[model samples]
Target: MKWLNKNRVLKVIFFALVVKPLVFIILGLNVRGKNNLPTKGPAIIAANHNSHLDTLVLMSLYPLSLLYKIRPVAAADYFLSNKYRAWFALNIIGIIPIERQRRVRKTELFSGCHTALDNDEILIIFPEGSRGQPEQISRIKKGLYHIVHDRKKTAIIPVLMHGLGKALPKGEALLVPFNCDVVIAPEMAEFQTADDFVKQLESCYQELKTYCITTTEQHN
Candidate 1:
């Protein structure tokens, strides 16, 4: 029960004892641009959504000591559908759940994300909004821009991932072991406008996705 309180100690222990092993050992990762991963917080990790593994793999990139500082931005409808799931997600996974269906102000929609960044925590956000087809990138959403438009100092790191969709696609719970690829871009430059920022982010995601696909073809 104590671990269900979002306890830092238990979090460290869980990532160390569980998540890391599952990510690295079972679902093997072939990571490129590992050095581009940020070591500190007040940062945003913008990645493509393919499977549930996307969040776990991104969080596992950080050190165990920094696990407490990692928050994955997830949808409230799916993750918080029930009390038990809400407890596990909030406590064990440490997600910032945002309501997708509620007609609320943009300020309220991302209040939790802003607070996390203000607290110097690293957020793992999927700009595609929700999971799409396996190994496919969807239209980049604008919520990512809203979270960072005012936070000038916050770093935005772009990451493109592949293979997880085939491993565990949306609407399925059974995970099939498959090698996954992660390509991380260096922290992106701050853009002056929301449109400019989202444009640059989308471009970056496309570039990474292309590189990943090309590299996979070469290996095969």
Candidate 2:
């Protein structure tokens, strides 16, 4: 399927992004606490990966038109596994692929990312570089810092996806019907040092954990 068709994207979104969310809600899925989305300008979206579904779910959370503008940062190897991912990354998600093996692909991806910035696009990055449990957010790599440090112009927006880990946990292709929440917090200030950025990244997870707890408390 063509990932992005100016005319068809709206229709595709209707089915995939919109209808699915409504279905999710009918099945008891809803996003709570998106007051966290940055109000303006390009920002870095740093999130924890719990399942293969996390990225798509996150994209769905974005208001219809804005979804296409949010480019996902994905691994070249995985997203390029087939025509589907390649197109998904290129057209639908706008992924910047990084070579897992060496710096060659990394440099190319980094350069492409820089160009995306030139176009004023927001980027989504999974600091861990792969999927894992919500608790593993702290195990994040320094690549996040490298991206932010290089493009010091953008803000880093911390987002927490609640209930998604359980919705489609690793190794499961089927998405479990459940209520999901995407909590967004405002963009963070630039880090003073590389160490400081890592600290802040870890802190984002802590804050997300707090949000999850509070949400549970409210519902209970």
For model 2, the run of ten residues with the poorest summed lDDT: 211-220
| Model 1 lDDT, residue 29, Cα | 88
Tens-digit lDDT track of model 1 for 63-101: 886788889999999999999999889988899999999
Count of clashing pairs, candidate 1: 0
Q: Per-residue alpha-carbon lDDT of model 2 for 16-130, expressed as tens digits? A: 7555565456334345457766534467788878666667766666666565567778888887889976875676566777777665654564776676667677778888778
Error of 1 at 94 (Å): 0.7
**lDDT score of residue 48 within candidate 2:** 79
Which candidate has the top score in lDDT? 1
Quick one: RMSD of model 2? 4.5
Backbone clashes in candidate 2 total 3
Residue 202, candidate 1: Cα error in Å is 1.9
What is the lDDT, from 0 to 100, of the residue 33 in candidate 2? 58
Candidate 1 has an lDDT of 0.86
| TM-scores of all predicted structures | 0.90, 0.80
* Clash count, one per candidate: 0, 3
